[model samples]
Target: MRKSAAPFLLALALPLAALAQAPVQYSLAFPNAVHHEARITVVFAEVPAAGPLQVRMARSSPGRYALHEFAKNVYDVQATDSKGQPLTVTRPDSYGWDVSGHDGTVRFTYTLFGDRTDGTYAGIDQRHAHLNMPATLAYARGLEQRPAEVKFELPTDWQVATQLRPDANGTYYAPHLQYLMDSPTSLGAQQRRTWQTLGRTIEMSVLHEGTAAELDAYVEQSKKVVQEAAAIFGGLPEYDFGRYTFVANYLPQTSSDGMEHRNSTSLTSNRPLRGAGALDNLGTVAHEFFHSWNVERIRPRDLEPFDFERANMSNSLWFAEGFTQYYGELLLRRAGIYTDEQYCQEALNGLVGAMLNSPGAARFSPVQMSQQAPFVDAAAAIDPNNRGNTYLSYYYIGGANALALDLELRQNHKTTLDAYMRAVWQQHGQTQRTYAPANPYTLTDLQRILGEVSKDTAFAGRFFRQHLLGHELPKFDQLLAPAGLLVRRAKAGQASLVARLSFNPADSTATVGSTLVGSPLYQAGLDREDVVRKIDGQRLTSAKALPELLAAHKPGDVLTVEYRTRGGIRTAPVTLAEDPTLEVVTYETARRPVTRAMKKFRAEWLSGKAKSFYPKPQPEDKDVSG
Candidate 1:
């Protein structure tokens, strides 16, 4: 029998023995002490021989729009083999590390100081807290897509929460390497709130110095958001999912914004909750929560197999970022957080704001803007001409386009964008398929999906090409007209007069940008850069009321004005002329009720259930690194 022992048996036995001898995977230690200071340590099974090892942080986290050098935060890195011997390590790039020499079991530890305005880490100094997630966590480069385990060691009293899969022992398990790298961990002295809806338990963790009453109100609003959003999605993704954490840093210097995460979002704002109302909080929560489905799960192809070393560009951000932006407010309205009037006003504000800012309304494409966003530095300093001529943020122009598309889709078929998204969810979300997997979802796939739901391939294709892919903005008024909503100038009769002054080429004093061609101001001889000091009895802070005051009088009305021209203070008398076209409005009448298709479309559009089909969550066994 000994002489007959097979070579195959011995080979199998040897491999099995090696596998059994491998050390039980342990945990990842992330220490949070100072708000801007932290450390990460990964302890793993020992390797018998030295092998090359690399670690990296993502170039940009899922929720953050700008490209961030997350790797810059890492410092004082060290690695030790199972025998407690130091291994040689070198940084291959700004975002990654390379290790050489033999190893059995190894532990990699590094101190990460995430204190900076333009880098990976963000700190809210006034609240004395920080939110560090995937942006600050590092993965073993190529191994990012593989299965790994993590454990957190935080400040004794601090609460830690994340969307990563958690094991029985509180160790977070990444089904594969990629999931571990993509999911972020949040740690701080934040107040946590928990709720249940649609057969799922949800949590809202907040970090603020505000009183408990204020925090409780925020939590209640968060629960309503989750409930409303879940109803729209059909159901929550997991029956026992982690809580949605809101890291609120009451930093007096912070602006109004929040970044989304897989299971949590960090919001920075100084606005008091009192006058803000539920609508405001609901909108904010909806925007970030929806990202879990859009950018987080069903991501752009380029974002998959992410390049942690540099920016990854994609033309599909219009769909990911812009479409979500459109849905954010719409969902709030559908959830009854805002009335129809409020929703319309918000939409109008976005549209008018975009149009009034630049003359390049029809020039830029969403895809081009998304691809080049990494190079556009400051948000405030962005030139409308530059955005108009070269780039257009999906958040603004693209969002407007999505709104039109939603309305158009409703008018064409009885189905709405909600159903289209649901079809996407059923097809991709349930199937866990990528846009172009080996079995990809192509343009044909999209067309077929839309056809199945709406029975209108022609309409879907036309909309996608003409508005989404093409540079042209739709006539939004046309889409809304069928619904009884009018897009028109705010008239003196319906609204108060508000004059806006435009600066001349010299960039000195404010002047008239445009006078509506036949406006009363034009007839009143109010030339550009007149710089009026007073109008009738009232001193003029701006030229806004000039037209209103003129419109108040008859065709033969006379008005007196004092102004500063190139010659300083002066006076002039001007006759007001009648405006034949005083106002142009787009509104709906009771005679034409919303069509059946339009009604269905509105229901589906307001509900976000349609997007559920794409980017289905991976199976429990699959790694999330991708």
Candidate 2:
């Protein structure tokens, strides 16, 4: 996209009416749902008498930071006046169409092509329509504050599920365009459940070809997740839309994704809810539910008025997204959905693979990782880069950093991270205040809050400088020591191999994906993409063969390896060494003795017994609803 555009001059037009219409209206019909398309007509009830009125499709949407170029999905646009006379509509760009000579009422119709369903994209099919408003509706220029109403025309049995305020006539109302886009509407056969607690209502509407009993069980567990998340924030934030909705679509053809919104969220997966992969959906649920306050409210100022024309970038995503990722898993454990051992395994995978063992840890910082989000955060392209060797995901780094910071607060200061998070919520995300790009918290603000919460400014400065800005990571073995848990290679005490290679069936060759930075493989000129053709004069068809050939050999054996490099076929006489890869981490608990203080810290951090729920849960020994 070009960095500059024509100056917007809609204000130069004269007002045709004494007062603007109350709500800019949109009428949507899915008569051709069988063809995977929908007909949408938007009415700008109060257009200026003359000058070009700009109506454009968004280039991106909230909770997403890529250039989607939504205009590509729209076509066959037609415009007219209220009296049915055709109006001249000019195409200014791929995303915009300018209209003139409207009698204070501008109406346009367009066909939208939607076949994919995810948290960030819109999908329309014969059975249902998933609306991410930015991808579904076009907004008139300079009228962002205008209230809007949406009317859907579809099968009578197909119910409407959204966070928008519903009117008696079946239309939905939004205070402004921002709220409208933030509200996603799911129309189809929905299995709905509502639970009221603490003077607020939480709703779940699932669209799947599954039994209702599984949904009931899911709703019961979700209730516990909600309770635990609120306990961390002191209380749930004020939901301006009167409720928080969880809209999930689990179908065989749908894509998997979970996107967070201000008052609602979309969760989709291809796994069967009652079959083997059912439990996977619960993790995305725990993650998005916590976002009702994290990025949705305690947002990055730059992402506030979410840009629909370009990518929205923020340096604070390490906390905005990473800290949220941290609590998502933590809340699941606190709710008793995940056992202590299970939680430890989750920690080991992220801590070791993302921070400790990852070669990128020595090359990148959390801030640098967050800056790469626009390119890697679910980007559509499939180009390969140095991710395995020179890059790390902020999700991993941030989550690990959050875990270390949390354990440090509990172990050394006898304080918890929950109190600090609540302080942030109260100051940045409490009431009806809508944050914008100009009003976000900076890195300085985060350090200030940490200092205030920990009552140690010097500690805050040291933590950020040494651990955050630097490549060094927090020591997890020492941190996990307090929980009576330990992490080691899953192959430890069994095998002596650590090399990792992936096989390509198409070429019948093995390729090295990762190896110890300074190990023998690195010293022998085995680059990442070097195709291994043979080892010790033996043919190698699969990566499995490498381990089999070396099974009889001990450490410190010199061997000849032949492979194809980018330059050409080459043979290197490399010295064989013990494998140095930690493929999987083993998390063991209750295998060691636990001290009294260690027991207390684990109890308080792992379980929310340190703080009580608003409506206290049943017996402390009871597990979450099964």
Candidate 3:
């Protein structure tokens, strides 16, 4: 049985009176920003003078599922009262401080050190300060419903790019704690562009050393992506304030990342917006922007009212993130970024190949894989793990499933995934949401929607049971046939162990990385760290030797193998198997017949959807100020 959404709604139902209380105010100074440090102060007014007021940094940030323990970078903690007198501070837990003798008010201060520029962490330097709010700010526990206001004491000539509503005197406001934490800020010398579309404003603010012409060119391409994504949902989600921003930092110092927020997405990349890197960077933009509707609004029940104190777990990311992943690339094709079926076919090949061959996908369902985000989604650890054997990314699994469902719907139901997504948006996403999503969806809700969309409840039930909950892969070979695409073995006659080999030139030995569970090498008792000395009594001289040896033989051939392991040297007979890898190619490329129906299906599925709409006139570049 699933948990009811009633309790979650009740907990989030805030009274209008609580919002009038004095907000938690914060001031961020960067005297030591050149050295990667920020001095932050927060004041909690109207403290009840109860036992003690607790103030703490967040353990996790929005859109990130792992426990980052943001408090690790905080130091030199101190507290004071309204009159500048020091207060008694006690460490009640590792994440926060408790202050007494406050007289109904407590001012907390801390020095934070950060040097990484990405979506989940704070990166501060002389050039810029990239702040993900949860990584940079502290909040009082009981004041979650009160208003929040912050002012940035930025360096000279530096400006801010964020989704936070601008108030007078360089201050920004959020309705409550959740809204504040969901806003990310990029402070630097930024180049800005804005355009009006579908009765809303869309802006792209980029902080890069590139020329103005380059930024303009990037924005032109980004606009196509934005329009295509919006067309999928019928229109853009009513963004907070009727404006959406893309807060981007693309510099050599910035790490490659993209995070989705309510009104904006934090995009950071080290790649320059030129040549191949430009197209590569646009892929991230396509993915994150689609999240504006899929995840940011059509939210998951598990991730609603996100907890800042621990990891947020969700079972529906397969659809939330996965369907978005499928569309991220598909939309790129629809926007003319990818001009050929070959480029698009590569994406399908990779998705199908991994899901079909990976042991992890064979063992776990999409729901189980979605739950592994806490350990795999940008999570950090030192020890080695067997994730290769046990886990497949929800992105790939979900994307593959999306491809199947879309084709199935088109062929059998006389509809498309686009129509189903539009249904979901109208039902779950297009609600009247303010500080947070008012109508996050659950698994049960999705099944019902699928039933309604297809007009066949039995098909929806069977699809969910066999493909989502059951450990079974969709039949891609049959699904792709309708699109004039063929899924065939990449190397039909080749023999492979399917295990990675690291060769040592000098010693003429190859150390096995991780042997596939049931491959010939594994059946012969060879595993990771085992050294292969000779195959069929031929000493290995170079990395190419193994491939050359395998080329001479076909599947079902048996050969003697010699290898060294921790136990001792041994010899065994191994039975080779055909390479199970699959690849997708157009029928024309494969010299196969393509029917008229196939041609029509491919065109209808991939052609641009937003081209019929009249182009919106571009506005002049706006100079953004903090």
Candidate 4:
């Protein structure tokens, strides 16, 4: 028996080696790219002798809260066994196909029709194939924990751009299904720039119809953004494969969008790397890069295990997305892309104005508003809803709160939001397990960390209760005072209906787009689609007529208004009110005195926090690796 032990050991080792080599394999080929179609094949091997295997396309992509039903684009699906023999396949649901009699191995193939180029959908053309993984690939149900490998049979002279770790055999690897779904790939003739910082490789792959010189110049600008973003959190996150990627597609055929992933970002725009469009596009760069830390790593618990089966709802997007929105523009200022006056006028002014004037902010707290993301975060429907009147984007609400909280921390606690962010990174985002975050944060964790950073539990509790859970906004005028920024009424002493109106010259009627709640128009029972025939007995002949009528009156003045509703023409006595819009301007711009204290406050708040770490990128350092 001892002499024959070798044969027994060989039998056990055979299946172990087979299991080790059995990964969910996926191969993509664009045979009909001109028609926006890709042929995809997935191989599931060593299936543990399971009776049936369920394969399906993801319903929703990451960084999106809506259910997109990606299965709608998949067709011509077929399956086979290990020996290339036909397997019996049955449609169990709209999204999945069940395969039986697979002999412990199943090969699934399908055709994916994709036409849109954005962060949430797949786009294919003669020029390139932009693929969001969840939209392009299918996965086997019980094989989620197995390693996944992707091989792209690219077009001539085309290469792949993705965060997926690559092997010498031209195959990309993901630890598991979660990482596989989050990786988006861009296949094209890409121009890329690579650099090393903090012992990590950072790559920017741009697929555009631009010159090499233009890409080099844009790389310089983007370098500044990356450095400034890293400074806020002390350094770059420890990337899984010791690399991070920016997959950008700036072409006329692509849609404008920026989506965040764990180790990379998808930046797409219909703008080129020339003129004002370049800087405008860079704004999205700062935003999605910041998300690598905020939403991708310092994640909300509601989104920790992102579900691909249905709509993913979260109540902390105000902090996840809104705070990131705040830093998106702020980081530009710190990087010197925006002057102080420009930052105050554009970013600060917009945030304060929306929070001050929006009826949604007044009606819903940040938490409540964030819960509405599943309905409004790019969700589509034919019938209209009252989102215009009831929704204030969590981005603006959270940004305004960040502005206030940052000031409060600086003035009262002698700390900065930067410090609190570092604390959050250390506690929740710094530690990681290969593919996902190990300590993704929760709402309670955010409050607790704020308390720890500020050394004031009571202040943190009060702030969260008042601004986050309650619909109470901080006084922006007072918060901006120390920094010598002014928050004042834009149109003081002027009467306004405070509603957006579209004038139709054909009928000489003004259509009310959406009436702000609590505004004069809202008080007068005017809503969306109502046609205003006259104001103060004057015909609304053009866009200027309503402003002229408002100018002739003052706040608290009553005027006769005639309008058309679904019930027909109606008349009401409308009491006009002062325009509630707010604006932010530096004290210097406002012709107010800027003292030494104000200068110090502004410098501390706006200046760059870290030294430059990247060397000047050279044109010769271009990397075209897929």
Candidate 5:
């Protein structure tokens, strides 16, 4: 049976004077069985005098990547007035409904059969049902800023869980309509677990057929991630603490990704825990959780008072997603999940990938990437050379830039990004703080904020304009040299042991039919058709043993590799050049002062560690032109 609600705060009473102007509440009852119809009832408080009130599904939800015309699932919609007179409804857009000529309190009812992929509603079979709101339900236009109360009615054998605050009589009150729309609620025969941290409660709801052991492990790890993240961010916000819900649907032939929302985020992955271990999961969780501070609350002007029907364009995704990405990994490192080497490797890997793949890196600016995200799918198959050239991802390149600036700031001020972010929390994250519609913090505003914390206006201004807005790639080699790591090509004739390989496998036998261009093997003249027979004289029978063989040699080492070529057996003696293309920045204890300063400077100015979030304020009586 569905769990009963515990006693909680009472719902905020609507102002009596505004009752006539308020819209009626809507209730939706979603059944647990897949393909079973779900019913929705909307009661209008008062009908309009001229035209009937209209209701429509959202074109898209915040943090989601795709356009979900949510109204597609709706069926059998009916409307009636207070006098029991049937009202007429017509479909206007692919996801909208237009009600005709009603002037009294009207009740609208509809049934929906859910089949969703990216947001809100999901159905695989009779065994599981997932529903994420905002993407599933329609909100009243112009009333999106008002407070709301929600209730869920699930099957007797099913459970309903959400991060929204609970109210008296089992109903929940969203802090505001935006929160009501952003918090996704899931219902089904799901396994649920709860944890508390920093005076806030965390919940994990997995809607899979996995065993209890698996479910419990997933929940425990999720809690650990939350705790670790809170430690780095200086704890969660006490005023509006909310839960984090994980709706794991173990579907075959699907990939893993997540969408962040206010208070909660919905994640879809093939296996709840896979790749990069617990720390990797922790970083993922941290990235999403940090959004509560960065993107969800401290938003750009275009995103605030969001327009749900269209794309909200702004040249600030680099700050929103990119900085959040940097923090995600940084928080993990600070929490001790990743060693210095692992963290360096991850950062270098991302930078190398972006540099090698982004063809438009020199042409299209970060601003363009942020503004064009609504149209491009970075993961889709396209021309390889031009894939990222004209289509930069604010998440990747912007993140690298942010990380560079963050590290630079840390070195210069002898502090960390934690300090700057704390300032942002104090200034913009307060519940009482309301950002202006168009006056949201620009690049200058960010620099001012950083100046307040560090008193380094010059450094902040240079970093923001030259690296972030001007599109100058940092001198990464110099940045890591101070840490005792040198960036150089492996000596010729010295074949270093293989550090890693990027490949896409099609079969279980670990046969590499294709390899990523610029990968070690690809640079070593290992063609796409070459069947690997041996490495360093060891028979290359399985993919697992290749790593051990590669680890035997240092940066400068020669290897005799044998593989099957189309013509015949082929032998190649390849010298590893420190994998120069594979940029790895590390720390060294001893270095000359000049080299150290260069490294420090790179870390401070070029590593994307600039302290400013926006551009600097101009001088009085000086006219600036872009």
Candidate 6:
């Protein structure tokens, strides 16, 4: 038999080594940003002899519950031995490859095209490199739990900002691939700042296409948001990681998105942090930072060990994502980003936005919608489909549910959702529960917590069955009344002809987006993607003119909608129907005055200065360093 080509095969096949002696290593270099590509190399210092080595691209990222097929961006892949000699690599599947004839050490060299910037995608240009870990790197099949090290050979002016802790020698290390996957790295001319609170450290790094003063101001206000947000969960989770980072990329080329991570977040936007639009950007900061406790730690059991090879669908995202959406804006209000009226407007928007997807809500429950993440969450739009007609986002449905539950808890239980969240925190979060995934909660577990907090198991069960697991919407009118708010119609209550018939506005050409199952739009023979050739003797060239003409009509008004089907142009008469709109009106008139009780309730629930519910930051936290 020929002697082995490389040594240390047994060591890699064994259990994970100490970080200092990790057998897996990665090096990334961005040499030619003009080409919009990065060269990535992975070296396995040791290899299993009995089996072929498999390398794979993640099917989905951590926070993004949707399938992104990150492999689609990977190409020019090749394998080599420890001495850089070529190895035989075979295609296993679209997302994976099998390598054989490798020395004890096998290395993979590939070029990845990444020119989109967001929290969940990879974007690289002469300006900067915004990378989501899953989108930028690949991993060995069985080395997900193996210790590894990552090195970035960046441009001279570029500084690397990532959540991965660095060793004394300046090399970033990951205890495992899972930890690595949760850490995103942005390499560019970043302005970095640091602050300390309650013995925990916060490091903010911003890479923007604006003046440095703007970034400085954004960081200053972000520190305040962090302070006010701590009150929601009583205090921050045990920041045993020693530090947390907030990585922001607000370049003109970056797509607007925000993704929560283990110790940091990837927040990108088209607007600079210095503009008048900066306040809106702060909401993304507040939202992702809160996830440091809620979803990241008090995670759904179904999503405990996130799948990297297939679409991971969870049924409890109604709470995981929806409750987070509810609190994201609520915390913004508490942080003074929104006025009393603005906050109420946001709540009203949430209610209406959810109901607009009513055709979907009418068929599926919040839980069902959450499970539809694979199809909707960050899902690419293919040809026209029924998503609009039957695909309400859990963000809306779940937020609406949260609004209802919060009011119920306040009115009936004399408790608030704040108490419930804190209780959940004490039980599931606190003490750095994010690192070691254990004691994850299920849908039933969440209901139990709610029942205990409300002191009514019946109410919790009913809420889950009807509002979460069933299609019944909450009674928003009753829920908002105690808080001096009630639903109002922004438009006439007359029936609508196409409230469910959506359109694409780019020179619309009478195209239909979706027709809800039972809407008059669906009954009018206007199917998805059908184009209207004429309606009531008018040659419809665009979608703009019909809405104005329809506004003058009401229910029982008969009209003809001539459109093109798959076969050819067709004509059908449609009866005008109701105007669908949801708005919340405050009790303001002198006759129906905003009552003292309602004012008190609203103040306590929305505007009043919250009592100091958390301990002050420690005295030793006077100095901050990064």
Quote the positional error of residue 50 for candidate 4 in Å: 3.1
Clashes of each: 36, 3, 0, 0, 30, 5
TM-score of candidate 2 on Cα atoms, chains taken together: 0.91
Find the candidate with the highest TM-score and give its number. Answer: 3
Candidate 3 stretches with Cα past 4 Å from truth are 1-14, 613-626
Worst 10 residues of 6 by lDDT: 1-10
The C-alpha TM-scores of every prediction are 0.71, 0.91, 0.94, 0.93, 0.72, 0.91
> What tens digits encode model 5's per-residue C-alpha lDDT throughout 1-626?
11110100111244444433554465767653455566777666554466646576776567743455667777788887777788888876677677776766667787767655334454423554555665556654434434556666666776665666677777666645556667766666666666655556566666654567766655555554455455445666543544555554444422355667766776655554544433444566668877766877666766665555654467788788988887777655544556656766776557644743455555666666677666653223344343322666788777877666666666667766667777766666544332222244566677777777667888777777776666676665655555555544323333443334322233212233444444456567765556666667876545556655655666546777776678788778755534334545453422334466655644443232211321343122121110
For residues 1-626, write the lDDT of model 1, one tens digit per residue.
23211321232334333433433243433435445565667665544354576556566654444566766677888888778889888877676677677465567777766553221254523224354455656665323223566666654666555656677987776554444444544456666666555445566655455677876676665655565555555656542244444445443444556566555565656555545733454567778777656565545555554444445566666767777888777667765666666776765557544633333445556666666656653322443232323455667766776667667667777666666766665565433421112222334555577677778777767766666556676775677666556655443222211234653334233464444333445555565556756556555443444445555566555567666667677777755543332221223322345566555544555543423532453232121111
Of 1 and 4, the candidate ahead on lDDT is 4
Query: lDDT of candidate 2?
Result: 0.77
Stretches of candidate 6 above 4 Å error? 1-21, 274-276, 381-383, 431-434, 493-496, 499-509, 539-544, 567-570, 589-592, 608-611, 614-626
Q: Is candidate 2 or candidate 3 better by TM-score?
A: 3
Evaluated against the true structure, the overall lDDT of model 5 is 0.58
Candidate 6 TM-score, true structure as reference:
0.91
After TM-score superposition, the amount by which residue 596's alpha carbon in candidate 6 deviates from its true location, in angstroms, is 1.2
lDDT (0 to 1) per candidate: 0.55, 0.77, 0.87, 0.87, 0.58, 0.78
Q: Name the weakest run of 10 consecutive residues (lDDT summed) in model 3.
A: 1-10
Residue by residue across 17-74, what tens digits does model 2's lDDT show? 3224457899989988988798999988767676877898988788877778788989
lDDT of 3 at 510: 92
What lDDT tens digits, residue by residue, belong to model 3 across residues 1-626?
Answer: 22222322443575777778898899999999889999999989998777888787898888889989899999998998889899999888788888988988788999999899999999999999999999999987767888899999987889889999999777999888889999999999888888876777888888887888888788878888988888787777788877899999998999999999989999999999887778888888999999998889899989987888878899988998889989988888888888646454647887889889888999999989999999999999998788878888999999989999999999999989999999988988888556566788998899899999999999999999998887788898999899999989989989987788999998999998877777888887888899899998999888899999998999989989899989899988988889888888889889999999999999889877876543553342233332
